[model samples]
Target: MLLLLCLSVLSQAAKAQETWEVFMEKIPEHLQVSLLIQDEEGQTLFSQSADKRIPSASIIKIPILIALMEKVENREITLDARYSLQATDKVGGAGELQHLPDGSGITFRYLAEEMIRISDNTATNILIRAIEMGYIQDWLKKNGYRDTQLNRLMMDFKAIEEGRQNYTSPREINDILLNLWEGKWLKEDSRAEIMHCLKGCADNSTIPSLLPAGTVVAHKTGTLDYVRGDAGIILGDKPLILSVFVENFESMEEAESAIGKIALKAFRDFGR
Candidate 1:
């Protein structure tokens, strides 16, 4: 058994080395990359600028989902509870809520699903209202995510212009997924519910684009004019918790392609 473990360690180290070389060679010069990958045992297989804070885009919704789940687990909120969408609630971005009629009532569960699955902007704002932003910020800080902050709601262009954007580090988000995968800080059922939401994510343009078909990846993706980020848990021979973020890209397609290549390298190396 000890010899087998030693072989596995050596294999992982070699894979990391190869992946590092690939990244250094292929990643474009215009973008900044932050990433972290961990095996099931919580050993970091690869990392680069993992501690740097960057704009979160819609990925900040993950923390919001976590806070909402905690509220549900504590009996402070009910998933079936409905909230009415005002004309003011509608915001433009990646979701169907903006197209829905005003005064339509949606349940917390449905809104949460939309937020993660489609990266819904309006659904996200409704959730922020349901579970106040203060609680979300407090939860992230109390949970040891020092670099993540929820400072503004989705589609708040004014806030963005004011420099009050949401932010998170690759390391912090990867750790969040690791905890969720292991059911460490949350009850198993709560963690399961969160994972269920994550699995519904529809944006397959980044990490999932290059992964083999039908790979079980429960993840969230965030995008902006110049930023792209994807983080998730990939179930394999040795489950991988991978986070990849690229910022300041000249184009989003290039950013996503870079992330896909990075994720594919890790998947091939560690998953095999």
Candidate 2:
């Protein structure tokens, strides 16, 4: 009985790999994509270029979020710690905080929530300053995220020009989500807080786009002129951890549609 079960699982994984390979081949030749899908048990169902590092865009926020939560868990910082917004802290892009006056004060909890919920650039920068970029980088390194880095602040065009862009890989992201799912590293309450914010993520055009309505997804999205990506856990009978990144794409619509198709396919194949 044990042998039969093992064979059955291997057969299913092989079939899923074939399906994903063929499906990926159908995407346009101009788009470069790296993808990985894993079951709740951290078993890889399908993968393609999973370790290839790609520009992370706002997806780098995931590491930032985790680092912040880790600090809170260690009592190095409190969520209620307040930050006074300064003109220099504001950045123009993907956040409401940019519109608020410089004197406005906000708490760490609010900044973290806004960072994930709305992909707020200003809120992210403030948190980065509060937590200190060195600590976040050290946390990521200590946690084994080799291909993920917080190299620059959000909306920093000058850094981009200097090639100091942030980056992450599909496999690393899947691992991050899997650890979160298993309650590794952080305490349960800290994990729950992160999930709550991710569940409220405003952007759903990628991984969750093709999933059924009200499908619970705790995810983050990243976008740049040449990059589009999403990574998250899909909650259901057969929960899945999916990470898909597309680079060098000419059309955002086409790239996102490709990502959606991949996610929907994973949902159906693994949910069985």
Candidate 3:
């Protein structure tokens, strides 16, 4: 039994190494990718440019969700509190809230859900205003996410034009999922609520699309003209946490397909 156990461990280690080599060899030359995959015990299964900063796009919503939950924990805000939406908050992007009337009202919790599950730009704008971008930045720095920044509100083209875009590293993004998975800062109920919203994310064209049927992934995806990112906890026998970011890809479809292939590789090699 002891010999068999040792050999099994060796086999797993060997396979993990092979997976990394395969990834490096197969990754497209024209794209810049950053990825990190870790087991529940915090063992890094594979990593590439994990510390490199990348454009955040909608993935900024993850940190926004955390900041919002912190307010709820401190009684600064309640999930049921209705926040009025104004015409100025509406922005053109992936979401239904922008099309609604200017005077529409939605709960803090509902806006959060829409922000994550649908990457709703209007909902994100409302939440950012409610929580304040400075508070979110302070929370991030306090929580040890030095590489992730909530520098601008969603769809703020003026800010983008001035080069004040949001950013996060793969390692930093993976830390968010790791903290949620471990229930680090959030209470059990808060953690559950966040995961529930993440699991409901409607865009499955990237990582989730390539996973095996019935695989549970609580994740958020982000897309931009030149960047695609997905990060979350993969619920499986091994329960891996992953963050993948691709920038300067030739196109959105190519970027997404690359992410899909990377996810499929992780699932096939690590899933039990």
lDDT of 2 by residue, 194-255 (tens): 99988989898898889888789999999898889999999968999999999888789998
lDDT of 2: 0.90
**Per-residue lDDT of candidate 1, residues 1-272 (tens digit):** 99999999899788767758676666787678999888877788888898999898888888899899999989988999988889999999799999988889899999999999999999999899889999999999989888899999998999999989899998999888887778776798888889899999999999888888888888999988877899888876668999899988888888989989888888887876
lDDT of each: 0.88, 0.90, 0.88
Q: Report the number of the highest-TM-score candidate.
A: 2
Which is the winner by TM-score between candidate 1 and candidate 2? 2
Kindly indicate the candidate among 2 and 3 with the higher TM-score.
Answer: 2
Which parts of model 3 have CA positions greater than 4 angstroms off? 1-15
RMSD of each: 2.2, 1.4, 2.0
TM-score: model 2 vs. ground truth: 0.95
Model 3 C-alpha lDDT per residue in residues 1-272, reported as the tens digit of each score: 99999999989998878868776688788888899999877778899999998888898899899889989999999999898888888899899998988788889999999999889998998899889989999999998888899889888889999999899998888888888788889899888889999999988988898888988888999989888889988888888899999887888888889888888888888867
* TM-score list, all predictions: 0.93, 0.95, 0.94
Ranking of all predicted structures according to TM-score, beginning with the best and ending with the worst:
2, 3, 1
Off by over 4 Å in 1: 1-15
Best-to-worst order by lDDT is: 2, 3, 1
